[model samples]
Target: MSVQTWTWILVGITFALYFGIAIWARAGSTKEFYVAGGGVSPLANGMATAADWMSAASFISMAGIISFAGYDGSVYLMGWTGGYVLLALLLAPYLRKFGKFTVPDFIGDRYYSNGARTVAVICALIVSFTYVAGQMRGVGIVFSQFLQVEIIWGVVIGMCIVLVFAFLGGMKGITYTQVAQYCVLIFAFMVPAFFISFQMTGDIIPQIGMGGTLEDGTYLLDKLDALHTQLGFKEYTTGSKSTWDVFAITLALMVGTAGLPHVIVRFFTVPKVKDARKSAGYALFLIAILYTTAPAISVFSRTNLIETVSETKYSEIPEWFKNWENTGLIAWTDKNGDGKIQYIAGSAIDGKKPVYTEARGSYGERLIANASAAKNELYVDRDIMVLANPEIAGLPNWVIALVAAGGLAAALSTAAGLLLVISTSISHDLIKKQIRPDISDKSELMWARGSIFVAILIAGYFGINPPGFVAATVALAFGLAAASFFPAIILGIFDKRMNKEGAISGMVVGILLMLFYMMKYKLDMFGGGTQDDWWFGTSPEGFGTVAMIVNVVISLVVSRLTSEPPVEVQEIVENIRIPSGAGEASAH
Candidate 1:
């Protein structure tokens, strides 16, 4: 079948499967809507959590980031993966034991103040909304690019799916839908990876191919290293980052991952504290399936991109080239008037080579080798490497269609999870706990569904006109999470003396600081026309690390100077630490 025909067919099938699951597993009560009736098996919950955690950023953009970020990008891999370790070891079991439907409940009760819970609700909303915006954007981008639809129309489609899943079936619906999504996304990601790996390295498994020998009997990585060195870029498999920056970025990612409201809320789905622990382990293992493959895909795609376009004439490039070029993702300026594309480290304009500097110029400028004519430049969009992988590797049209479904699956699953969190926070934490204590379960459930619909609309708007790439938006959200929520959540769980004052103050400080940093970097510095204006020479991506540290320190110091939680609050903390109460802990 043609790409369009296959895309429509695959999309129809995918929608049917998801809607079927939602129908089969529809939630009948608030409990089911919020936590799938708390009956999810450890394995099932783990799988759902994996799907919930791996959003469009993971499926669509992570490999692309690594493809360009080179060694410095290892921070993303380590930080994102290592976070599960922290979640399992330090957070999940206790949060599960607390038996709360929302992260705010833990903070509110532990700190003995409704204010603390309110603060948490605000933080959760911010994190979930910011995070969901990126997923929505991913959904729209995939549809617009692959399906040849308007971005608004793509977002509308995604929003409708999310609404049906969240408002109609709730967590139960989302859970099963997420499992299906995981399968489709992982298969779509791996099939092309396998083909490319085998084609390049004679290895079927992408992870092994990443380290295997190339056709010339030299290590693939070794060749990449030589190429990078030849092009005046950093080596492929080593760190070129300052030690402190690497440490901070990695630490921030780990904490940010653990503290992500969407990921944390998944623990509530398990039946017991031990089950939560086990589910976390399963989540990480499932995550590793994709995370490990992502780097390999990055490397392979990077190599393929360099080889395919380096010396080729722009006119002679494949049809895919023109398609992507139409998206403004790929561009060429024949600076030297040469017909051949030039892939090089520096610019050659009017017969003069001008050095381009952005620090991590790891992928050298494309220069046609030894061409006497004007330099033919090729600018490939980073997002293209993953979405177009199947096409680039000469895979079938169905494979490309599968990828479209996979991208949608990844975006939708994560979006559904985030919307659920946002809904619960509004309905359970904000409304039920604060505004109307007498609200019935049915009323609260209705509110939750209503909140989901509103959240979908808000997120869909951003998705249709996304301010930036998926990774850029997600990274900024991570910074926001780190600044606003991570410190409060961590201190609330660990420090006995932490009180409402400390928690609330910390959240405000962290969020404001993070916003300031983000605005400077995204709006004024790197994003705006003003170049050479980074604070502390830190990229916006790395600034979150510093922001997180400040948040932690401020929270700790402020807590020490303030009054401690009440004796009742201390008992609440102790209760959370124990594993026995989860099974019978009454729902709020």
Candidate 2:
């Protein structure tokens, strides 16, 4: 079968399975919609949480970023996985014991103030919306490539699919659907890795293959480092980022991962506090399966791409190159008219007009020139590395199609989970909790469904015109979460003296500071300046680490000045710390 035919078949089958699961596990009550009836088994919840957490960034773009960034990319592998440890050890069990429907519920009750809940709701929406945008973009990328549709239409299609499951089944439906998605996506991701690993290193395990010697008897990392240096790029093992920046980015990502509202909400679905802890362990194990392999996949794909395309004649370029070129992700300008593509690194020369290159004539000949007059002639979009990996490795069509299905499954499952959070925060936390505490459950469910549709539309818009590459955009969302929610949640659990004044103020300032930095650097707001203008050389992506520290400091100072949390709230915290009787304690 052709690529398109196989893609249709595989994607169709996966969607059918998801739809069936959604129908089978359709939510019938507010409890089901919000927490899957709060009776999900640990193993099942773990798989669902893994799917909910991975998103399109992990499935489609993480390896792509690592392929290009080399060792700098290890931050993501360490940051995301390490954060799960924090979740399991510090937050998940306690939150499960505190056990309400959402992250906002804990903040509201713990702080004894509706204002705190409102602030938490806003933070959740911002974090969830930002994260969902990237997932939608991932969906669009897959659709544009496989379905041969415009990115806008692709996003619309994705939105519809998510709506079908999220609106109908809510968390109940989403959980089961995610379990299925996890299976499909993990299998799809691993098959390609196994194939590439065996072909490159004669080893079947991707992790081992990455470290093993290549067919040419050269160490894989040694060859990759040599290739990078020969092209004036940083070594594959030693990255270019300053030590401080790497530490900050990694820390921010770890904290952010634990703070993500959607991820935290997953703990609410399990039956007991111990179950939540076990679920976190299961989740980390499942997630590590991909996280560990990502770096290996990155090494393989990067090496494969360099060998296959660099210095090759433009006319003799592989079919995969042409296919990607049509997507406008791969481009070249033959500045010297050498008729060969140059993929080396080069420094930018000031005052040089960028001679934009375009493909021309029957042979699709194109000039290759760097926009900044850099040594490299080709600009390969980082987002395409994972999606195009199978094609580049000369895999069979069915495997490629399975990858497409996997990417979509990754994207749609996370999208559903995020949209549910956004809708739940608005309908349950904002409306039902603050505005109409006496609202009927049916009415609240209707509001939740309505909010989801609106949220999906907004998410789709951002997806069609993403702010950055998938992983980078997602990193910013993590930054926001880390800055705003992590501090408050952590302090709420550990410090019985933490007051509404402290938690609310800390969340507001932290999120606002993060938003200011991101907007200034990423969105070019406020007469934007370059990285040189960044404070202490902290890039916008890593600035969250600084902001999180500021939040902690400010919360501590403010809490000391303000009256402590009420005695009842302190008792509630004490109760949550105990493991036994958690099921009964949480019921209240």
- What lDDT tens digits, residue by residue, belong to model 2 across residues 1-588? 898899889988989999999999999999999999988999999999999988899999999999998889888888888888888898988888887889998889899999999999999999988899999989888887786655677788888888898999999999999999999999999999999999989999999999999877999999999999998888989878889999999999999988998988899998777788788899989999998899988999899899898899889998888776665566766655687878888632222222335547344753334455566677777777888999999999999999999999999999999999999999999999989989999999999999999999999999877778889999999999999999999999888889999998899999999999999988888888798898889988898999999999999999999898889999988878887777666642
Q: Which stretches of candidate 2 lie above 4 Å from their native place?
A: 346-362, 365-372
- Which candidate gets the maximum lDDT versus the true structure? 2
* Candidate 2 lDDT score relative to the true structure: 0.88
| Most TM-score-accurate candidate | 2
lDDT to native, each model: 0.78, 0.88
- Looking at model 2, report the run of 10 residues with the lowest lDDT sum: 347-356
Clashes (N, CA, C under 3 Å) per candidate: 13, 7
lDDT of 1 by residue, 261-296 (tens): 878878888777778888889888999999999999
Each model's Cα RMSD: 5.6, 2.4
Q: Show where candidate 1 strays beyond 4 Å.
A: 150-153, 229-234, 345-376, 465-467, 525-536, 579-588
